[model samples]
Target: MDADRISKLPDHVIHHILSFLPTIDAVWTSLLSRHWRRMWYYVPTLEFSQFGNKDVEIFYNFVDDCLKHRMMGMHHNTMSVITRFNLNTVYRGRRSKVKLDRWLSFIAQPHLQKLVLNMFEYEPVRRRHYCLPEVVLNLASLTVLKLVFVELEACYPVSLPSLEYLYLGHVQMEDEILHTLLLGCPSLEELYIKDCDKLKSLRVSSSCLQFLDLSGNWETFTIKVEAINLQSFAFSNTAWKKPCSCRFDLASCKKIENLSLHGVSFYPDEDFASFISGLPLLESLALDQCDLIDIRNQHLKFLDVKTVRYKDRDQANWDEEDWDKVDWDEVDWDRIEISIDAPNLDSFKCYTKNLLVRFLMNSPNLSETFIHVGYCAETETRRREREREWIIVLIDVLFLVLLVELLMFPQVFRRNCRSPLPNVNKLKVEMGGYDEDGVRDALLWLAPSAETISIELEPF
Candidate 1:
């Protein structure tokens, strides 16, 4: 197609294509022709990046030109805007304050829905402050807000009636300031706080909050969450000095389905188990590196009357003497049952081989059982050491064959030899064939097709 013909596409189509490009690239389309010059101004999404140039003058000039273009043809509201203004005091140090104020004032439009501001290493250290004007709070149309490395002089305690998701990363604020913000957003559903070292306590009591993530903190912190409508929750890598405590007493969350806890420690298992058992409709539970206290007996009591028959022993002569020989004390059997309880009991998985065997032999009602071998570096190292010893014997036969070839068939080797003799290195590798055998044996004892075996090993 001809250039003129291609350029005659609808303005909406042009803006749609421009929306995918960086804001600077889209604005540069102004040089294409007069028709395309103002078209970039109407684009819905705006993204600007200032890199390599330490001078703030370049940033101010670029922003000024874009804003001037926007105002010249500005009629309708823009959908969303994402701007990354990297400023340095080298060139625009004298006009830094004026430029900063102007930049914030330019984008403080009520029509702006999503606003993202990222400023890195702006100088004139004393003047380096971001003031969110009261007009920002009045932007009722705005929903998602993200701020990075920006300091707020006063907590913008404005109610966001439309806000659903809020993310604050590396933003400094006091506990009271954060609480005020949370209290203002009545309809907030998801909140994420990461690397916010200044925050000490997060007191969240929202009726609409369904998901919450608190990770990466420098100092001790506590979170008081009371969300009756909450369904899914995740906690990762957060520390507390005096044992942080949280109370989840909301009963309105009857539909609460999934719970995931990562890198968290609870003092008492009874309290946690009781809370979990109360959720009648709960479906999935995931615990990763979580410290659960004294759960063995409680789990056994929960899975009462589930009988296990040893595959090697005949069912007719089964007695207590057969169970007495089993190492009941060493087997942490309760964790396996808790892992498998589905609508009471269905399937379960265990990391330890012995525990898995005991659970299979004990749980008569268990429909499926999975034995996951711990394949971390320690286990891999041990397996590799054994494999190396075994593979060495196999390689010895190859070495003898090579030595015989070199002595008896020197002419044959010389005719084919463009390269030197290959290095016979004894490399260590893990064999999953053994794990498959174990799974087969376990399956033979249980229902023939009831048990499925799968082995996943760590990458070399």
Candidate 2:
């Protein structure tokens, strides 16, 4: 298989295959010929951009002639360094911030390991950021950092001893320079702070942090987390305009195992069940657009709840005639009474628009139950007979039940619905807008012991 195997490799493996192309195809491999002129300047990953340039001074003279041919090819490759430098710009003024601080002090090299700065605002002017350069906190061989709309300043013996993955969007630090940039990244492990609103109050003392994503700190005034080997935690302040008297303290996270809260609004000195019972290894919990009254956990298996369509937040600050002066059919379906004593709960997924969710208890290790409804479940035909009598008294012992999926939109059904879907081994019904008298009243109230039954209808 050697038909001139990629021009017979080895110039550092063809500069690591042109460092994964595109710096305009790695400068068109120097017009491919004389053994590929200068091998794309010993590529070790240098990405520049102006995305589909519309003459932003020819992308600032093509990144100033590719950093002057990578500093004159470092006098003929003296062990070429640059290990990944991505700069995504939209051309700001002041000579593009002095050529982006002279191309980040010419890639503060120590063999830089992954750095991406995405400065946006591609034209409809007035919104300039980009302020980070104390030689980029002295990049001591960084290990993955993505900052967008930058502006962070903290000059204090910052360390960075081999940083490990940090992503900050809409950044603009100053909470003591974000606690000296997380105490100078001591072996940081996956941190993503999104939509940063100048971080009001934050403290994440990490000891090799596992993974933490905190979103849009609206008026964040308290988020003191002490990661004791944190294993996945996510928090979202749902674009805060109100409901964000922020306070999230992950009680010294005891090896948490995946917890996600979107549009979070937890108060009362933040005792969301003593921070989820001190995370005795939480399994999985996701609540979108908050407000799930009370949830008890015993190593939760998986629970997802969705409901909070605040006009899809910020549709240009929504005002399509104030959504026709609100009156979604007198708007009140009252059913936010949720109480779960997760006795090793298996799986429960729910997406609602007309609330009415009542599962006080009884999921003897439920197998899988997914219910998604937006409307027309016959306008809650008497709350679907008390939600099918508490879903057959919550899966009568779930004989290792397989699957039960139901998604309705325009469909509606109501019938005697005798006892059959108890040990649901498989039953699926998804309809967006259907009529056959709504799948014959959802097959006469879906009595399924399941020998396989699938009904999907969603066209229109």
Candidate 3:
């Protein structure tokens, strides 16, 4: 009955509603009314990214016509109306490259605030890539730049005056080119570098950068960041056996509050302690498969360590001779030690392999404690041999203490805290393995306070 109520809305409200719909769908709404036809021109964001199985030429023409019509609708004064332009498609050959270049050149206006160009090769049999045009750097008004599967070279100088956020994933660029790009974006506040194989080192000294994420490049030799205003930082390397020892030099980032490291081994080991000590404002820290000889932080509230053992060829860098020198299976668990000192820590999560753990300070603020401890051996015989060893008993005792601390308010397990089997608190134990029932039965005696226990087969 009130059909015109939808169309009677203000033009600005209509345009805002249309902005969420796909650009093609928004254009189809033109048939609704004369008022709706004109509203499409004011929908500031244009996204053209549907290229599933359609003919490449048809897709290219569709994008071309859409841009042309949007440009024609705008008078000379509306040249800078389009603020966001996103084009994601599978680029095949030189023909796709030409169309992409034309689109980039068309959108290189003074008011373009955000630009995303994600071109991937859908046909795995015939992979093709596009060399990013130098004109993209000339977008002085652009505040965010996200590029995926594009190749960049230092042939052209970089210039992005207002850019604050930059994300480059699966991009191919040399170390010098990446450095030049970082240096050019003076106002950049957030930077992310992922799966860029050519980048060997990341050295960011931007005072304005507030967030930084660098990961997925296994060959990266060093990471040295000195952003004084940085609030969060994350670094990851999935590969286990690396060619060179990974070094993270974040000492100058004094204002950092949150930090994460995954699969990144620390060299000179003591550097891990110094790194945490320097970040006085840190509130959250996560370490995944990273070396943790010592973690001493007074301001930390949440800490998570996922030290799961993963044995795969992908984790191996066979080309490096150093990888063959040490056998991971034969690593001495007794020698592996972790010392933690956090007074105000609220939550602690530890999923570790065989390692000696010692909490130097009683975390008075801790409210939650989760510990998953086990010794993974190469074979069933070796696992049984290890289960009979003295460490297994110690591990059971440690688990009981960890659960007791969880139930009690003030931690009873402080420095020099030790107990064997005797416990008092509500505890739960869950095990995942083929012999889960057997494993649970063996460990239940050590945790008499355990009120709940569950066992399931290992998913993997």
Candidate 4:
């Protein structure tokens, strides 16, 4: 009774739909009907993933046979252009390299716009990086290329004039090879390189580049970038290092709008406040597990900071060899005294177990503020009380411990926030191990004008 309306779609539409399925599944669709018998031979995209197959040779054969059929179809004038191809498998031996080379060479055509080669092999005896085949030397038409766990066969430069996006993860390539490869891509816009431990020098000089993300435990290196039009940059590394290894010079990227960093230690020469002030167009900033001494900016609108204290970190999984390299007395990691001065800031968030963030002036335009503090006992309380007004930030940090400290003596809270927060309309309080009467007095002293106050606590 059904006329198979969907199957009557145009050839190009059917090919587009089949592009999302694995090449094997697309080929198996030939069994659906006589009309779909040879449809897969013309699909523009092919994806082969050797995930569930236990027999490596059988999987290799399937890929080889599939490509052979495609080549034959092209000879017969039945196949069209292939714009994208994704192949994920393992490289076990010389035969694997030969097969990979054959496949890459066949697909390295002017019409191939995107190519992804992800071969992740897990062997514990001795980790080794696979060599890239020679055919990848020139893929002029590729717009996007992603390679993981593969190294260039040689230190020769390759050409990719049309490339706009490139990602290399766990890729073993010399600093010279990487520098030359970046130079070859004149149109590159976004580049990401991560977890490639073999690199020591990072040099990216692109006029049209917009975004760059680099993450790894870079022990010591010289990093240089000359991207005039860059808008966003991100760098992340593991924490607990006293002094950062790499020194940076980002004076060329003046157009940056958003920045995120983690586990980066500022050296004596690199002033964080000066760097923050230099970015006039910057609007958003986020720092995680990074040193924070002082920050002063006028145009910022959003700020978020998350810091870690030495007592809060767990060193159970850290490599013993690496742990021995750290000097515990380099600096008092427990003393986290941070100062922030942002007048136009609209949103602020601070999450920490033991750290004090001092804001010089109140955030007049602040619409949202969230502060969750934990594990600050008598020692931390005394250090904070003796060091800071501790009253200026009472309006921002509503943690139970700090509140109890400031609320224990209600006069300090009243004098500092002389006027309750007039903008606070809804308030919620959770109390434990404190008298309800003291909690009530603190709320009245802090936000007496709050229209609605919700309290959830156990009677002390």
Clashing pairs in 2: none
Strongest candidate by TM-score: 4
Q: Candidate 4: how large is its RMSD?
A: 8.9
The TM-score of candidate 3 is: 0.77
lDDT of 1 at 77: 42
Q: Of the candidates numbered 1 and 3, which has the greater lDDT value?
A: 3
Kindly list the per-residue Cα lDDT of model 1 for residues 235-314, writing each as its tens digit: 55554322233444435555556655544545442276666666665655555434342121112212212222222334
RMSD of 3: 9.5
Tens-digit lDDT string for candidate 4 (1-460)? 9798879899889999999999999999989989998788889999999999889988999999888888887888645678899999986756777888889889887789999998876552455556886567578889999998888655466888999999999898888888888888999999999887778878999998999998877756567889999888888875335324556668888888888877777666788888887777778889887775467778878888887555434432245575456443332335466666677777777777554444444355555566656543245555454334344455444441223444444576477745445456777876556776777766765666888777787666
* Candidate 3, residue 50: how far the Cα is off, in Å: 3.1
Where model 1 places Cα greater than 4 Å from the true spot, the runs are: 1-5, 52-55, 75-100, 120-131, 153-156, 218-221, 238-252, 268-270, 293-460
Clashes of each: 1, 0, 0, 0
TM-score of every candidate: 0.61, 0.31, 0.77, 0.78
Report how far off residue 145 is in candidate 2 (Å).
5.9
Q: What is the lDDT of residue 322 in candidate 4?
A: 57
For model 2, residues 32-56, the per-residue Cα lDDT tens digits are: 7788877888888988778787788
Q: Which stretches of candidate 2 lie over 4 Å from their true place?
A: 1-94, 106-138, 141-146, 150-161, 170-186, 193-208, 214-229, 235-254, 263-280, 283-286, 290-324, 332-339, 343-359, 362-460
